[model samples]
Each structure stands twice: as C-alpha cells, then as structure tokens.
Target: MSLVARAKSLANRDALTRVGLALTAAWLLLVLLFWLLGPTGTTEPSGLGRLVRVMGLVLPLALIWVGVSLGRSIEILRAEAADLRQQLGRPLGQDSHGRDAARAPMPAPTARPAAPPHGQAPAPAAAAPSAVAARPRPGDQRQTAMRFEPGQAQAPIDVTTLIRALNFPDGPDDHEAIDALRQALRDPDLSRVLRSAQDVVTLLAGHDVYMDMLPPNPAPAAVWRRFAEGQRGSGVAALGGIHDREALETVAQMMRQDEIFRDTAHHFLRHFDGLLARLVPELDELQIAVLADSRSSRAFMLLGRVAGSFG
Candidate 1:
C-alpha cells in the first residue's frame, strides 16, 4: 500500500482499538462480577466454576490483545508526532522551488491619496514612521506604570545579579533597580510565582519573621521616607533565622519555576527581595550567608551561592 494509505489505515485502526478497549473493559468488569458471585464451595462441581475457569483463560488473552493494540496505537501516534515536528520545523511558506517567502523582498507601500482636490478643509495626515520612531519609550515616560500580560515572551531570571541588586544599599541606584524589579513582578505571567513566593513569605511572617527585623516606623510616611533616603542601619543578622521545612519547599518550588519560566518567578520574588532590602539595607554577604544557611534546603543553598558571589 501507499504511505498515505497506510497512515489512513493506522488512524482508523487506532480509533477502532480505543472503542474496543472501552467496550472490552466494561465486559471484563461484568465477567469479574459474575465470577465473584459464583459458588463458594470447592466440592460443588458447579457449571458457574467451569464457566468462570473458561473466562479466566479467555480474559488473559483478551488483556494481552488489548495491550498489543494499545502498543500499536502508541507507535502510530509517535510516528505522527515525528512527522508533525519535522513539518513544523521546516521554514514557513516554502514552495516546490524551495524559495523562502520570508526572505522575499516586500512590496512598496501604496501611494497616499492625492492632496484632497484643493483643500476642502484638508483631510488629516497619517502619522509617518519617523514620527512613531521619535516617540518616547515606555521606560522613559514619567508616569510609566508596570503592566503584565500573561502570554508575553519570558526571559530567564539572572539569579546572581538579582541577589546582588537586592542586597545593594537602598540608594537612588538601588531604588531605580527596585522600581524596575517591582514593575517586573506586576506582570500577569508571574502570577503563580508571585502567589507561591508570597505564600512562603507569609508562612514565615506568621512565625514573627519580620516583627523585629523591620524598622519601627511610627507611620507609613516614615517607612517611605526611610526607604527613599537609603538608610542602612539594620544588620544582615536581622534577615536570618528562618528554617521552616514547608517554607523551604515553597521557596524551592519558586526557584524551580523560575528555572522553567526563566525570569517569571525570579522577577516575581524580586518584590520580596526589595521589601527585605528596605527592612535591612545594611545586609552584607555574611548576613546573606546566614540567611542562606538558615535551612539545608536547595533553595537556601542556591541563595547562599548567589550571595557568596558578591564576596
């Protein structure tokens, strides 16, 4: 048979096999019930026993057949997946002549409408490409607010750099870095990462983690002012002492997700890092090492390594 014919036949066979598997499963269950309800006495010489014995033999064969069918179906699926991967990996819009549509020169833009037949209150001009290019970037805008979209392209988190940035004294430089990091956290894509990290922080906070660690500000204004002025009185020892297993697991999971989603989880946790820096602007490598050694978990160990890099 032709390759296409064989593929079609395999697809049909797979569908039929699936349907048969469901029906056979139901039949097997019914047979099992019948066998269970059969006579209990060994000396009975009952017809039900004989019937069950025959079914027992038949059931094994049926199961073996089903297994083989499933195996065949899986093989067919694997083959199909391989084919699809190969096709998708090829350049888009490739023709029989092997020309790449993407590389083809684009057509010139159509000419604009002629000058509106002598100024009957002339039509509005379309904005030129140069005008668009001259517009300020979002980062340059004074009122720029962080916005997150769930499906935006993700970049990996630079764990070492992030740790150093977070540990930096709260000066104008660190404040700008913190603002950028906070904006990154507001991204919707990091929602899960944020929640997970927040859960860990909250769990630790429940144990009075930040009670003595944070500044004893009389008001919110004081807190904000302290953060703005780059104050650095608190020591790194204040950030240490957390050793909870559950919280460690949560942190580990956040790190794993950061690895998978790249910067997604890492940026999300930057919010916490900034908050910690605000609480202890004088945190040094030794203090970071103390926090890192608070638990033997992989997360803490990784944090320790990041902190040690600064030394």
Candidate 2:
C-alpha cells in the first residue's frame, strides 16, 4: 500500500492521535466563538466580551499544544509505516524473523525399487541426493547473491575467496562479489571487520589493479582470526595492501581503544579519525531519544549494553 494510507492506518490505531484530534477540535471551536460573538464596538464590556477576552489569552497556548501533539502523532505514524514497508519488502522465502523457508535442512532421499520385466521382482534403486544437497554450491554458482540479517550472527568474512575473485581477469568489475561485500557491510555486528577489509580492497582498486592483480600477499588466517577478536596490531598488518601503514594503524588503534567506539564506529570509519569526533555523542543522543519508551526499546537497549560489555 502507499505510504499515506499506511500512515493513516497507523495513526487511526493510536490513542494519542485521538486525543490530539479532540484537542484540535476544541482549539478550532474556541477560535470560531471568539471571531463570531466577539464585541465589535465599545458596549460597556458584556459577558461575551469577558468570555472572548479569557479565550484570547488561552487560545494561542492551547493551539500550540495541539500542534505539537498532532506533529508527534504523525511522526510516529510515519515511522511505523516505514517499518511495515521494510517487513513487506523481505524476500519471498524469508520472514521478518530472518528464518528462510528454503534453507531448512532436507532429509536424505531413500532408494526406490525399480520395476522388473513381466513378473520378475523389482531391483532396489540407488540412494539419491537430498533437495538441499542437490542445490549448487559456491564453486558451481559463484555469482549467487549474499543475504544480510542484522539480528543474526554474521558468517565469517571469506577473505581468501574474496581475494580469489578480485584476482579474476574481469575482477575489478565483479559486480556479484562487490554486491555481496556491500550487503555484508550492512550487518552491524560484522561492520568493523568487514569495513577494514573493504578499505584494503578499495585501495587496491585505486592502484590500477582491478580484480586482475593479486594483493601482493594473502593475509594469513591468523591475522583474520585476530581481526575477528578485535586485536589492533595483527588486524593492521593483515591490511598491509592499503599502502599507508601508519594511517591504517592509527585508525585501528583508535577504534579499538576509544570509549565511544561502539556508538560512533560507523561514522568514524566512514570519515577520518579526527574529523567527526564530536558527532560521536550524537549517536548516544539519538539512542536515548528513540528509546524513551522502555517497553518498545528494551531489547535494543539490552543488546547495546551487552555489546558494550565486550569492550
């Protein structure tokens, strides 16, 4: 459905919107009475004059309150509608909980007896592959798109496979791999590790080395493990292909040690180290504003606290 209809449906369901509508009606009635029965000329100040005078003093304040309430109600409706859109846009086999109908483990196929000629007994059939097992693996379908779910644990970044893809003759323009990496970046849990590796990949592209050239040397599995563990030194060395060793090391160190890293990691990584330090606090402000309702945001608050404990 269209956003307006979706938003209206949400607003109609909200008690606060009903209250706002009542306040708006009251405000409009006061304005109409003041205009219609107000004293036109000096008549020794009648009862209507006194009533209009009192309403004149209260009308502006009441109108302001009504406006604020309606504005907030509309904003809440818009946010709910946007969330509905996200839910509706999910893939056909996937639900809002991230469960995939097609990803469920399949049972192994059993052998079937074969028909024999005339009255002869039938021979047993050979074992067959399961539905899931019959599906193509990465080796067979390298161009398959990746899926990202923010609430779930991310699969480990496959640097070896990524490097191999980058070294293809048409690697620079390997849209499938690039799209997969981009999709992976949307996972907040994997952003720190994935972004660092992506920086190295972006650097390689700038040096006339499209997917056709190697990254001088493949990073050892130990480096990737240390990266997954949030270690500073090994992670920096693992990304040596970036050319600017000193700069990468500095950013990595700050990201690992800073108190506000969890709150501002996305922004700092997007920009440089010192460019937007003040902006880090803004994330906390936004979290507080959005989490004002304890019931609605308790899970997110708990998750943030747990993630902070890791640091």
- Give the top-scoring candidate (TM-score): 2
Q: Give the TM-score of each candidate.
A: 0.23, 0.27
Query: Residue 162 of candidate 1: its Cα lDDT?
Result: 32
Tens-digit per-residue lDDT, 234-278, candidate 1: 322222233444544544554554343224334434544454444
Best by lDDT: 1
For model 2, the run of ten residues with the poorest summed lDDT: 128-137
Cα error, residue 177 of model 1, in Å, equals 36
lDDT (0 to 1) per candidate: 0.36, 0.35
148-211, model 2: which lDDT tens digit per residue? 3334445654432222222221222345444444544554534443443233222222222222
Query: Could you tell me the lDDT of residue 178 within candidate 1?
Result: 44
> Model 1: which residue pairs collide?
155-263, 156-262, 156-263, 157-262, 157-263
